[model samples]
Target: MTIKHKITLYSSLFFSGFYALIALFIVMSFASFRAEEFKERLNEKALTTIRLLLDVKELDNDLLKIIDQNSIHQLYDEKTLIFDENFNLIYSSLDDTKIHWTTGDLEILKTEGAYFKSEGENEIYGIKHLNNGKQFYAIVSANDNYGKSKLRYLTTIVIITFLVFLLATWLFTFTLIKKQLKPLDEFHENISQINDLHIERQLATKENSKNEIDLLSIEFNQMMSRITEVYNLQKDFTAHVSHELRTPLLKLSAQVENQLLQQKGENDLFLKSMMQDIAQLNELINSLLLLTKNNQTNPREYESIRIDEVLYAAFEKISHDFKDISIDFSIAESVAETPEILEVKASPNLLEIAFSNLIKNAYLYSDNKKVQVKIYKDNHKLKLSIINAGSKIADKAEDILFKPFKRGENTADSKGLGIGLTIVKRILTNFDFSIEYTFGSYTHQFLIIF
Candidate 1:
């Protein structure tokens, strides 16, 4: 069932059961109390009748005569039964055949001052020993008309009250549930209004809501924010990758096309230039793939790495591959006093690829024949800078240089796939590291912070 309906049903059931128990208790207690009150009034009347008629000290028929003559004896609904000491009926209102009067019934006057009770139908009878216990046994019966009516009335009222209470409880509980869930419903509505265009707007998590639903809404919005950030990064990365890869591919394809379509036999120098362009294209493709692979890995697998060692190893690999560039490095040692040597924890292969691309860019872009690689420690952060006497990027180009396939004014002299720095920045970001480019009158510098 839906949460709203489940809440309503549970609320209804809880109130119904509670009201039912309360109704049963009230009806039973009220009925019992009213019955006791009626019985007390009946007893009082019976005692009064016994007191007025009976002369307890005398064994005579004088009181019986007075009782028979009293005009005030109009309150009681009674039948007279007179019995002897031997427990045999002498004078009776009920015929012996009608009641089948046994010794037990005729022995109502057990002593000189005995009062006893018996039930017939819905009325109760109080038999009082009277007339000196010789010839008269006073029988007074009272019907509990008020008591019965009170019970019936109370029973009806109890049922009606229970029904009303049940309805009220259900409505109140369901209304309360709806009130509690209102914020959650609003939270969902706010989230639904959000899409790629509206990613910047966050949900309102009110402080007054000291509850789980509020926390859930806040966390959900945070997740959405992160997703939007990654999505934007991916879009920028894609655009940069396309722009970077296209130039090299076109150059390589043109070279192949020229070789294929030529009528004359291709010279060795022309074929060599074509092969060099093909190699540059292949290198650009490899770097882009490495960037994509790093982003695709399960993030949980990344770990802390020593920046100096990882960079030194990457530099060695690049130096082996490109023998033309004279690469030099100075690395600091890691220590308890110098934990800054370990900049971040990340996938080893990915960091290597990123650093490798940065060093290779300095080599490819440098007009002078040498590249300088330097490493240093600053607190817990590592700073690795690669400097080359190469093309000084334009002031305008600095803005879009990190964007994929973005080339600068100095681009004409070199074969570049424009996305190397973009990939490097992306890979470093995955490891929580950052990159900054410093361009000067004669220096093109890239700094990686660990």
Candidate 2:
């Protein structure tokens, strides 16, 4: 799951538990208050009935009933009864019957003076009363319908309010967490896009807040500064060293060639050998310089050129170098409706160098000096292949083919600097092109897709 979903889920659970606890507390408190209030009102009714009866000596049972129905606060199923010491009913506010009171109940009330009890939805109480040497007992029973209705309404309101609170809390928590972590997301995007070419770019930071993300940005910028410094120093060292060595090598090559032409003794043979060695060194230096230059060149400097023209030019140069090689070159169009111009965006010089390297390798390694170069259009792409009849390359050769100074196992007898494919790979990668190799039983082909 994403961080946003995880945060929302965890926070919603927490708020649900917290709100449930609050709802439980509120319901319990309200229920307790309602029960106590109702019980107190019942006690008040019993006391008031006793006071009215004692204040008026000549009050009849019918008169007392009339007073209670009119003056007393009426509850749902309210009942009041007064009994003599002998347990005979003396007065009852109810219509027909007295409250069923056992002797055990009366004895308990006599000793305790008063008792209160609740049964399901109703409350009952009994009290012993004594005045002017006469004793009596009062019992009251009632159901608090108003209290029950208020509690039912209260329960409904609490449930609804609690649900709304949970929903609001969930939304508020998710939004708040997402907003706070947006800076981290931006930091990740910026880091993901960083590469060797974009080493100078820095991650974004907030000016108003110096939170964790801001600190991270500041540290990243510092690290990039150090990396760029070290990289520039290394590149400058390579370029300068190559230039410094190339001048002396060129001078040495010229001196040796001049000496070979002037001398006619046995030492002339030695001078010729020296000249060849010097030429090879000069070529090595040139390759190094070219690789460095390709690395530094900007992609925007490329121009459009006909790919077929570039290929033919490279093949012509290679033919002159290896005249004995039998070369076959062809271009076939898969679809007649395709345009004649096989153009692509690239540096012509880099294209010629890369193609020349492939063509030279094909000629040098083929058993019978037989090489085939094919160019065709397929699926809206230009496909070029350099196929040569040769021994199969090693299975693992493809892994290191494009690495600098890496030679295949089949190159034991061939003369090479091994930077040819390296240069080609760098050039093609910079231009968003692709190259692949195919090794067969009697033919090896290098394919370029543009």
Candidate 3:
């Protein structure tokens, strides 16, 4: 994943974990609050019933009748017992469900004083002392029906509350985090506006945030500025160095040719060879420098360049000096479907130089005056290839073909510098294009992918 995706994913996960923690705290707080409320209700209801029973008289008769009365008695669902001074049961309203503890065991409440209490078998009892050592107790036993319903209700409330908390917390956290990071988004947009041509843009300085973010922006802008300086220096050096070498090379070539013309046939052969070598040397240096200029070039003017025009023009230019060689050009109508199809946005001069160098390389390789240049395209990219008749470059020479000063094993008294291919490589590379050379028994091919 990209950096932006990773940042968003991690930010969301972090907030999820944070929201989970917050939800846990909220759930716990609500549970504690609810449990305390349940306990408080139990205590208040128990005390009020106990006070009402104290006034009843006729011990057994009134107590039995009062235990079943509509108001206070119906509050109980299971066994209920009342006690007189003798500890005999004054009123017994026992259901079919067995109560684990009766009024006898509930005597523990007398010592502990009036309070709401629980009995086994899901029963709750309230006990209170009457005047003269008499006591009254109420019981409510829990059946499966009430227990299941109450449990279901409580569970539903908890789950609903938990879900709501998760949703609400996530939404709220997302909003807050988005707001906090809004400046980062703005900074990224500002940076994009500063193109490769000018990458010196910096984030707006905020007095409140003199932190790591500010440090990052400061460092990033500095790095881009430094990179730009180095790149410009390399380009300028290439152009200047090429121009400087041209003058001395022309002088040397002129002197060598003059000497070759004056010398005798036997001596002049050696001088002529030297003259040819000088000429090739000049061409190589010129090509290498031109390649550098093409690669580093960012000319202001560019338009729809027809592939056919550039290919034919380059072939004719290189063919002018070499009268002994023959080059055949072929362009399929399939490739010429559109005018702009061959039209790449580039400096015409640089493109022409690159094309010329490639064609010249093909001609130099072909000892027999036979070569072919083909122009074509695959989808969005353009491809140009030059094939020449020559001995295949050995495997060793193939590896170092694009590097400066590297000569092939078969380079006998070949009249050229080794930087021709290097220049082509550099030129193609600058425009995000690729070049590949394949050599076979009598054919050498240079492939250009644009």
lDDT of 3 by residue, 156-217 (tens): 77677667766776567567666666767776777875643334445675655666666667
- Model 1 error, position 26 (Å): 2.6
| Candidates ranked by TM-score | 3, 2, 1
TM-score of each: 0.43, 0.56, 0.58
* Model 2 per-residue lDDT tens digits across residues 241-288: 989998898898888888877878989878887887878777787787
Q: Write the per-residue lDDT of candidate 1 for residues 1-450, one digit (tens) a residue.
A: 869879889878877887788888888898678656755665565555444434354624455535533646432344444554555544433312232234554455454344434456334443545455454443435456656777888899888888888788778877898898898788878977664335556888877666888888778878988887897688678657856887868777777767766735647567767768777766666655554442544345666677767877887898798877788777666533566545466887778888888888888878876888887767756688888985566679889978888888877777788888888777777666789899787888888876
lDDT for model 1 = 0.68
Top model by TM-score, which number? 3
Off by over 4 Å in 3: 1-19, 40-139, 143-241, 264-273, 291-300, 315-335, 356-450
Checking candidate 1 for backbone clashes, the offending pairs are: 240-404, 244-405, 303-345, 304-345
Clashes of each: 4, 0, 0
State model 3's lDDT: 0.64
Candidate 1 has a TM-score of 0.43
Off by over 4 Å in 2: 1-221, 294-301, 335-341
Stretches > 4 Å off in candidate 1: 1-16, 41-86, 90-142, 192-201, 205-223, 247-450
Worst 10 residues of 3 by lDDT: 139-148
